[model samples]
Target: MLTIPKELPAGFEAYGRSTDFTPDNLPARLQAAHSTKAGTWGLLHVLEGKILYQLEAPFEGEQLAAAGEKIVIESEVPHRVKFVERGRFFVEFYRKAELTPG
Candidate 1:
């Protein structure tokens, strides 16, 4: 596993851990554009080579996630990855914090 940063954006908390994957073993659907259910977010970690993270709706663009780099996936948003070269990476899921009564 790559050394992912411990700091997370405000209001976000990692719901799961120990997620590890690589291009050679990645599922076909994950390699394609797909969105998580509402309120769920994804964090892609690049441990080697380079990969492209693309947005399709609500926003549109492509980002390079190379070694030591990570790409954030907004909730209910369309996105995909195109392998640029031999690479290794993993994804971790996160969710927003629920507000407490004021």
Candidate 2:
């Protein structure tokens, strides 16, 4: 039960609402995947328990995270995540309009 931002700008879209899961209640050999729309970014925050995540790109970083840790990644940046313990959390997906001028 968390309130997430729903405000989106032009060329940006939110594919779906935030998702929550409990590790203790999840079946073994389970993994969740979300596809990102082009020109978009995704954010995931751990509100409880711990988890391990790895981004299959230059943003690669792996470690165990406890409550209050957050991870942000851009679209097409393949990543994998696993729950370390039974807990609650939220994941948000957002799209960006344009790339910043280099």
Candidate 3:
């Protein structure tokens, strides 16, 4: 049950960035991700094992996000270390400036 975000507003496109932290020494695919600093928004999905989502500071929140579950967050938010997972996961970055008014 993979859930993807709805389409962005007019003139906005999904900008994606991906990095594989799966190790060569291990049989598991483990990766961790942090959002971009350019005032972007993103969604992270775990295509294999489970993941943990953590928020820093006054946010004081944490959740055990699972495979096929998508988490959305703003880049500028104080939250950090959003996800730590094992297996395939990808992120798509979005920004308000990318959207053009009709």
- Which candidate number has the best TM-score? 1
User: Residue 61 of model 2: what lDDT?
Assistant: 52
Candidate 1 local lDDT, residue 97: 82
* 1-102: candidate 1 lDDT, tens digit per residue: 122233546798888643566667777887677888888877888888888887765566778778898887777777778778788888788998888899
Residues forming the 10-long window of minimal summed lDDT in candidate 1: 1-10
lDDT of 3 by residue, 1-102 (tens): 222233443444566666632323222322233335765777665666655655554455555666776666555544443235455556666766543588
Error of 1 at 57 (Å): 4.9
Estimate the TM-score for candidate 2: 0.60
lDDT of 2: 0.61
Question: Candidate 2 on 20-55: residue-level lDDT in tens?
Answer: 767755434225443355677766678898877665
For model 2 the local lDDT of residue 20 reads 79
- Looking at model 2, the pairs that clash are none
RMSD of 3: 6.7
Question: Which residue ranges in model 2 land beyond 4 Å of their true spot?
Answer: 1-16, 24-35, 57-60, 97-102
Give the distance in Å from residue 52's predicted Cα in candidate 1 to where it truly belongs: 0.7
Per-model TM-score, in order, reads 0.78, 0.60, 0.59
Instruction: List the candidate 3 regions with Cα displacement exceeding 4 Å.
Output: 1-12, 21-35, 80-85, 97-102
Clashes within 3 Å, all models in order? 0, 0, 1
